[model samples]
Target: RQIRSRFIDEVDSGVVRTETGATITQKADRFSLDESSSPKKSTSATSIEYDWETPVSGKTYKSASGSTIEYDLQDGDDPFQVGVIVEHAKFGPGKIISRTGLGMDAKVVVFFKSRGQKKLMLKAAPLQVIG
Candidate 1:
């Protein structure tokens, strides 16, 4: 969707062309929600902070954006612990719901946003730790 929005922006600015070399007419690219249009946005007076606890790994994570994600991935031996987000070529993106084993023999049960929960081998699973 983000790529599609950028393509529309390019098309609106007359930077995109069709296969037949046809160019679109340029016009205003301003949106009602853009910073140039709506300069002031409402916000809460009190800052609210939250935390998430992983069901499988029994770990709690804090995210400023309200999403539980860990960034210190360089210090961990087991990267597939609960609350870790991972991306797979086939499974897309998901959170690790459960995991077992160790090293190359490890397995994780990830709950993919689009594909739902799936168990995959840590090795040869086309997985990348992305939390």
Candidate 2:
């Protein structure tokens, strides 16, 4: 009777460790095409800009890097509501963990737990609150 959610799948990286704690690695088929490593070139030179503002909430968001973002519930919410999208200068995007007066904390927290992810700022960062 439960509807499975995609959010659960996004939680961890697919890599798994054995009981001995030795690393396990997987390989995918390798194929090379000329376009595989090619850079995408935009035909149009027009600039696209979006100024997001909420009249009721009085929230504003703007980013120049145009990085992809995602969000999760703010800990206590039920039915898994979406929270704020926390962007970083170097650590990329992550889910907001807790909220404070200044801003919210986010943890990238991948299964592999990259060094950068551990060092990623989990306390104060600019956030875009959404439903």
Candidate 3:
């Protein structure tokens, strides 16, 4: 006895083979080969803006009420504790709402009067305690 084989192409399916008394089926490639279907590039540059304000380190300024405010960067005091009133040149007066971590890796969150809330480093933050 002799066996014959042939290939069959279906619209919905992939390659099919028929050999004498047996049939085999395969799935077609689902990916596209055309370059026109590729993604397009934008003509304009993408713009990104940050909402957080950067405080100047070791800077001093006078408040609107005629009081001189200065940030002592070298002060070896843990003034960034919670519930402490701190003043910044850019964010004005703010209260330390929360403190996280410890030592050099510590961070504090301050709720300012006009600048909302800001997260700053504890040791290097530009903040001065208001008595």
Candidate 4:
């Protein structure tokens, strides 16, 4: 007998598709050492595979002043400027509430419309500034 399962693991802008398969084999009753014993127990083994991908984070947004700005977050750069408008693929639009630390250790707190507040790492978070 065989069993299979599949699922998607998502974190910020990154996504992983996981698939797993298991196979089980039972011994015939005649092969059992004791004729009166229950059917021989079987062990099942599972194999798993994953496919990962990351989508683009944010886009260039134009403000009311007609000025264009780039809002995407990049590694080794400070992306969180307090009070800036930013958008997250999963959390929608939000505003930067506060920020702490520097470089890869930097963290930003954002308040979203649908998801409320969230704290994210600057380098790993899938966030983009809108204004």
For every candidate structure, what is the RMSD over all alpha carbons to the true structure, in angstroms? Answer: 15.5, 18.5, 22.8, 16.0
* 2 versus 4: better lDDT goes to: 4
- What is the C-alpha local distance difference test score of candidate 2? 0.32
Q: Give lDDT tens digits, candidate 4, residues 1-131.
A: 43322211112111221122222222432211222322332222343332223323465655434546554656534446788899987799999999997544568999998999999876566677788
User: Which residue pairs in candidate 2 have backbone atoms (N, alpha carbon, C) closer than 3 angstroms, thus clashing?
Assistant: none
Q: Which stretches of candidate 4 lie over 4 Å from their true place?
A: 1-79
Cα error, residue 63 of model 2, in Å, equals: 13
lDDT (tens digit, per residue) of candidate 1 on 25-123? 444664222233222322223543222121224334443335443333233556778899999877799998988865445788999989998998765
Q: Model 1: how far is 19 from its true place, Å?
A: 63
Model 2 is weakest, by summed lDDT over 10 consecutive residues, at: 36-45
Give me candidate 2's TM-score against the actual structure: 0.20
Report the lDDT of model 2 for residue 21.
32
- Which candidate has the highest TM-score of all? 1
Report the lDDT of model 3 for residue 72.
47
TM-score of each: 0.41, 0.20, 0.40, 0.40
lDDT of 2 at 119: 28
Candidate 1 off by > 4 Å: 1-76
Least accurate 10 contiguous residues by lDDT in model 1: 34-43
Please tell me which predicted candidate would have the highest lDDT against the true structure. 1
